[model samples]
Target chain A: MPEPLLARSALRAHVAPEIAAPAPGVVLRERTDLTLASVAAFKGREAELADAVRSAYGIELPTTPTRVAAGEVAFVWAGPGKWLATATGPVDFSTLPAAVADQSDGRSVLSVSGERARETLATLIAIDLHPRAFTSGDAALTHAASISVHLWQTDDAPTYEIAVFRSYAATLWRWLVHAGQSRGIDAKL
Target chain B: MRIACPHCGLRGVDEFAYFGDASVTRPAADAAETAFADYVYLRDNPAGAHRELWSHALGCQSWLVVTRDTRSHAIETVEAARDVALARTSEAQS
Candidate 1:
């Protein structure tokens, strides 16, 4: 069999060196909910959420420089004026960007591909994904079943990323599992 | 939508992107802060045809003016930055 085009370990490194490969057949769970987000600060004006988080804490989050291909990186927009770049690590969520990084808060990063990804997401998402409205790199930040999840088409893989508040990750995961089971597919990760 | 981005050639909706209304008039030189804020932030989402500014940020990265229906998402016009300025006044009057 041809080797897997992408090594999850390599991909993980591309996001963060601290995020090593998943254990053999064991996906990383400590940071079970994986998503990429960022905050692009322009002259330190516009919006801020990370700065506030940092003022309260003393750690800085990882941030990828803009203009690089998102293909080589996993990132997401965390807010209207910011983004959040993520990977596995005991990240200091309180860290904030200094300049433009300091201005914007972030946007969203959504997981949209998985064995039964579409089927699982269909329960909450409303955008028409039938080849017409969705293709690779197609993203939308709208309500899926009244819940806001930034949707993005991951590199044509079966695992997609979705971003939601920390409070709803479990509920969203449960919904995905239920939907996946209905399709005779088990979405364990 | 796959726009023929002036800079990046042709890219998917993910490569290029959208901005808000393009025809809204800018605030005058001594406009109040609130008025200026409204001009900069508020979008005129008319139900019918509208001129909107879009960018191929992930593509060629040039500014584009696209005429699309606010309700139906039908595009009636697509032009580069230079031409979009020409239609600005006519759009504001409509």
Candidate 2:
């Protein structure tokens, strides 16, 4: 398959990494609900928004998009000046670039990774998360983990999750476990 | 790709549509059809920063001008530009 985006340098530069857990370990977990901190921002002037996002969050978006027309995604627009990015994976919040700013309402992140991580998620997420179609650096909004979440497949982290509200963390985690039980993914974390 | 429209907020990248080369001006239709054909078809498939136009067909339904790089898959700029503004900008010399 094609190489995943956010390679060695990029992942190190952006991911807010925590130590990887053992195989079959608790790969997915959500901390106590913390108020949502801004996760993204945009700046334009000489077409510097990508740089801005890189400088701010260390994530890079594709340019001169050559894919088929994306006229269907606009159906969810809720504001005039901002779009909420799906925040997932390990984030290094302290390194957020100064050029960009975060303006998200109270939101938080969830961590999901482990040997059984894929199997675990497969039970709950109706969609696919294979490396080919939903590999790292890809983001999708879906109803999974028992909540509406912005899913991010982190680079090399071997973990993934749905970025959801603090209130939904517990329920989502519970759902993740239930889905995995059949496959023996009784992750306690 | 989920693009955050400066005017329409965060929307799926699919909702916004792409236009032709943003920096190139469409040749006159009355002129040689061949040159116009080349204008319409031939393009510089560059590896770096490229400016193009896009429209939010599913969201605000407004036109936008964007600057992006192909090699790196990095978005440079996504701006709200009307048809007239984009045309004028395309016509301007660097």
Candidate 3:
């Protein structure tokens, strides 16, 4: 039999011991245990797709630039009629009435939390990230440091998740490190 | 400058890419060569309010038709390109 495949982090080469240590100001963690898929409803069939998704995942599909989470599954609006669906476990979208493309290995997700999370992100992204402006469950399909990124606030602890194309993961990590340099980053690879 | 994306709310202009006049429509395939050339190469430089095509490249990735005052740099309205096209189709049908 052939050798089993190995899963490796996109930031494996960039993970330095000093950066990985638990710092006090900001906590950054890479999320690799997610099954991601891009879902796009066919023209005039958005309602049908939403209904199918609701029945399958028990969560409403966000029609705007927002995120709706039910248990471990979350649907983030990427554009008009388009959404990025993520789950901790495998989600079968085969029967859904929409175009679905698996993105599990195509994207990288990083979670930023703690007191300086918002400030650090504010320096990189152009959107208004204030607590009142961007509360929990709010998501945006914006860019960070010129890299297209999808950002969402998961909780009031102010934990934010930023997802970027896998190829840009290292660049995003560098930007995060630079942004959090003075503030102290607790990066967990 | 900022564009209030219909679906994404207000966003910086840098997040969007200009695609020129939204008023331009494709001519029929069997139309005259002169008409095809005009459609492909001609654009009117208007000083007043104009409808332009812009794509939100980094945010939401929606094509928008923005009606803006060229002289004042003020945006009067923004609509999704899909909706605008659909409306045009319905108008033509009706």
lDDT of 2 by residue, A13-101 (tens): 22232333334444555533222233232333323544655555554433311111121111111223233433323333324332223
For A93-180, candidate 3 gives per-residue lDDT tens digits of 6577999998888899999998889998999999999977898999999899999999999998789999899999988988898888
Residue range with the least summed lDDT across 10 consecutive positions in model 1 chain A: A21-30
lDDT score, residue A138, model 1? 50
Candidate closer to the true structure by TM-score (higher is better), 1 or 2? 1
- Ranked by TM-score from best down, the candidates are 3, 1, 2
TM-score for each model: 0.42, 0.42, 0.95
lDDT of 1 at A43: 49
Write model 1 residue lDDT over A1-189, tens digit each, in one string: 987653132122222211222321111121343433444555444335445534443323223112212223334443334445454433343354433231011322334454455656666565555556565555545445445465555555444556555444555555554454445443333
| After superposition, candidate 2 runs with Cα above 4 Å error | A1-26, A31-46, A54-105, A155-157, A186-189, B1-94
Ten-residue segment with the worst summed lDDT in candidate 2 chain B? B3-12
Better of 1 and 2 by lDDT: 2
Each candidate's interface RMSD, rounded to one decimal?
9.5, 8.5, 0.7
The lDDT ranking, best first, is 3, 2, 1
Task: Estimate every model's Cα lDDT from 0 to 1.
Answer: 0.49, 0.52, 0.89
